[model samples]
Each structure stands twice: as C-alpha cells, then as structure tokens.
Target: METQEANTKKVVVEKKPLEKVCIICAKGSLEDVYATLVMANGAVMEGIETNVFFTFFGLDGITKKQMNRLHTATTGNPAMRMPGGIPFPTMLGGLPGVETAVSGMMRKQMEELDMPPVDEFLEMITAGGGTIYACKLAIDMFKLEKKDLSDEVEDIITIGQFYELCDGDRTQIIFT
Candidate 1:
C-alpha cells in the first residue's frame, strides 16, 4: 500500500506566462488617486505592462496645477473627519479656507507615513515602463488643452484608439 501510494504522484504544472495591461480610469476623490497609484506601482513591480487613463476628477492627480491641491472629501461624504471623530461640519468645508486646511493636513499625514505624492508615484511607474494617457473626451469636456496636463502624459487618446492600442496577442485588459 505504501509503495502504491508513493507511485500515485502528482504532476505540478508551471503557470503559463501572461502579459497584462491595465487601464486605470480613476474618477473619484483623492483616495482614488492614491489607490490608483498604489495599484499601478504594484503592477510595475510585478513586471506587468501598465497604462493609466485619467479622466474627469481622476485627472486631478495628473493636472500640473491641481495635483497637489486635491482636497479630502467633505460635505455629505461620511468618510471625512474633523479635529476628532466629530463629524466634519458640512458648512466648514464650504468656507473659503477650510478645504485647503483639510487637504494640507491630509497631505502632511501621508508624507509622514512615507507615501509618495501622486505625481511622483506616476513618474516612478512611467520610469518603470508604464504608460499614461489623458482621455480626449475628458479634456474637451473640461476645456483642457494638452498643455494643461503634466509633461509626463504620453498622449491624449480617444476610447477607440486606446482600445486599439491595448489589443494584443497575449494581453489581458483590466479596468480599475
């Protein structure tokens, strides 16, 4: 019985190598920007080719002017907190200078935690061979010109063009 059991061996098969492409369409608040950067970095570290297509509010992270100015969620957003567990007063966020304060505090905390800024993280991914694109429709909708985006942006692409670019022999499409 021991000899029979030993003869019943299993064959371990190696995983097939696959190429993956990610299309990160970030369109949420600052948290979304952080999440997108983190995922993009992870993919790059794994040697997976990646592309980030920032549109709408997501573009804030790539905008030359607003990249560092993004604010934490306020208003009816339940995720935000003020000086303490005390709910962030909706009216306070509406005030002229409070948003900046909140955004600054958040940025400071993130820095102390050693997290890279969004733009810098994007740069790291690009340096690691990841691509970045700006959606043409979003640019037009926001009245943004190519000059308005960061120098790191590779190109402004229509959805069809982006799809064509991403299609390949052994690529998997991932939309985040």
Candidate 2:
C-alpha cells in the first residue's frame, strides 16, 4: 500500500490547460501594437487558441500604409522609457522621424530576443490556427477599403461577430 502511494505521488505535473484568448487592440501606436502581438504570441506558445480584434486606432496596425511604419510613444504615455532608466523627452518624440527611429530600436530589441517581426509573427499565429479580424466600424469610419488591409488579416468583422467567436469556450477577453 505504501509503495503504491509513493508511485502515485511521483507522477509529473502537467502544464496548465489550454485557454482561448480574445485580444482587443484599441491603439494604433507601436507600443500598443507590440503589446497586442506579444500577448498573442504568448497565448500561442502556451497552446491556447488566440483571436485578435483591431478596432479604432488599433486598425492602423493592420493597415497597408502604417503597419511597418508604426511610431513609438515619446510622451503622454507614462510607460515610455529610454535606455538605462532614462525618460524620453516628449518634445523629441514630436520631431519628424523620432518615432520611427524609436520604433526601429524597439523592433531590433525584439529581434535580439529572437522574437519574430510583426508581419511574420501574425503569419505564425494564423498558420498555427490563431485568427485575426479587423473592425467594421473602424474601416467605415476611416473610409478604408478591404484592399487597404494587410494580406495577413482574415476578415472584417463586426463587434457582434467578434462576440460570437468568443462564445462556448473558457475564453478570456483582453484589451490592450
């Protein structure tokens, strides 16, 4: 009896069960876009089904003109930080190309950490069964056409549609 109990206790623990994640991206800036991407990647890594919904300013992330030209936050974002704990000046960020430069640096940092670029990251997620959707309201408000969206996007969906996708699972809704 004691031997049987010991054997039972020796069983290795399993990782957490896979959960479904619904990520909402509401901002168009590089930081916000990266935040959404990172979370999606994490969910994928943890064997979870993930869906990303881009709405409002967040739609810029998937737009044809701005996807790769995202800008970094210099001011008005309390989380913005420079190298070695330095705080970036809000004025500098307003200068032309500063945001682009900062965005490039952040991308490089991610690359150094062996993380994939946003484009390929989205590709990986979709290829791995994750889903991406653009917001209908945003597209209409911005006068955007389907042709203006990135090829990686799955479709343009309404808020109601997004809710429908979240149904019937232990789904977690997160807005970044």
Candidate 3:
C-alpha cells in the first residue's frame, strides 16, 4: 500500500519579482535591434528598472543618421524565408536589391502590426523611464560624437559603469 501524503509531498520556494534589468545590444541588424528594444520595452512596462546599453554595431540603433534606416540581414540567416514561409535562397539573398526588398517587407509587416519605428520605439522606452546608453569604447572606436547619437541616449559610459548598474539581488543582465 502507498500513502497519498508521501506521494504528494509539498515543496515551497521563495517568490520574487525582478527589480531591474540590464540589456546589452551588440548587433546592428534590424531583427537584433528590435529584439533588444522589445525586451527593454517590456521590462519598462512591467515597472522594472531598465537599462539598455548599445555597443559595437548595435550603435546603429542609436546613431541619429542610421536609426530609422536599419535593415535586416537576410544573407546567411538560416531562418530567412519568403512571405508565405517559403525558404529564401541564400544566393538570392546576397543579390543586389534582394536584401533591401526583404528588409522593406519586414518593416512593412511590422508596421502593419502597429510596431513603431526605431526612433519612436526609443522614445516610448524612454518615456517609460527606461535609460538608454551608448558604449564609450565603441563611440571612440567609431569616431562618433555625442551629438551623432539619438537624443534618447541618456549618456555614453564604459562597460564598467554599465556593470555597476547591474548590481542588485533581483537584477537580470541580458545580453541580446
């Protein structure tokens, strides 16, 4: 005979919500940038302290000249496909105009889904009290001035300063 109490043992664990989120954006492609933005935005919406740091090629998302003109990388993307789910040929993806057309289609699809433009998305995130930062090392390497970045950028800081913000028992550091 088996005892029901023994078979149905109870387990208790501590429940805690994330208090802060530090997200790092290191890629420049449209999809990657959007992924970072979406996560940061979602965290802000949840009333969590959100800090977004853009570095390397990801600076394109905050660069005033390129923010609105970001494009998706169709070539070498294994999951890239046509509108109806047909697999896109890698060779065709590398052809002239194909990348642009595909990126345009992607942006169009996002727009149809009511997604905001990069600049507007940044604005929304900031409006929600989320902080945006540019990596100082990347800025120096790219020869970019603070004025070249989007107004939404709160500051340019070193990775060390960024890590300082990651301190907290309930903080999450996300590298996207």
TM-score of each model, in listed order: 0.81, 0.83, 0.92
Q: Per-residue lDDT for 1-176 in model 2, tens only?
A: 99988888777555656589999999988878989988997898788989999999999888888887777676576677788988877887788887778888988887899877667777877887888999999999999988998888999999999998887557889999
Q: Compared with the true structure, what per-residue lDDT tens digits does model 1 show for residues 30-148?
A: 77788887887778888987777888778887888887677776677776776668887788778888777887888899989988887787788899998889889888888998898
> Compared to the true structure, candidate 3 yields what TM-score?
0.92
Whichever of 2 and 3 has more TM-score, that candidate is 3
Tell me which residue pairs clash in candidate 3. Answer: none
By TM-score: ranked, best first: 3, 2, 1
Candidate 2 differs from the real structure by a C-alpha RMSD in angstroms, to one decimal, of 3.8
Q: Assess each prediction's global lDDT (C-alpha) against the native.
A: 0.78, 0.86, 0.94
Worst-scoring 10-residue span by lDDT in model 2: 9-18
lDDT of 3 by residue, 68-102 (tens): 88899878899998878899999999899988888
Q: lDDT (0-100) at residue 39 of candidate 2? A: 92
For candidate 1, the C-alpha RMSD (Å) to the true structure equals: 3.4
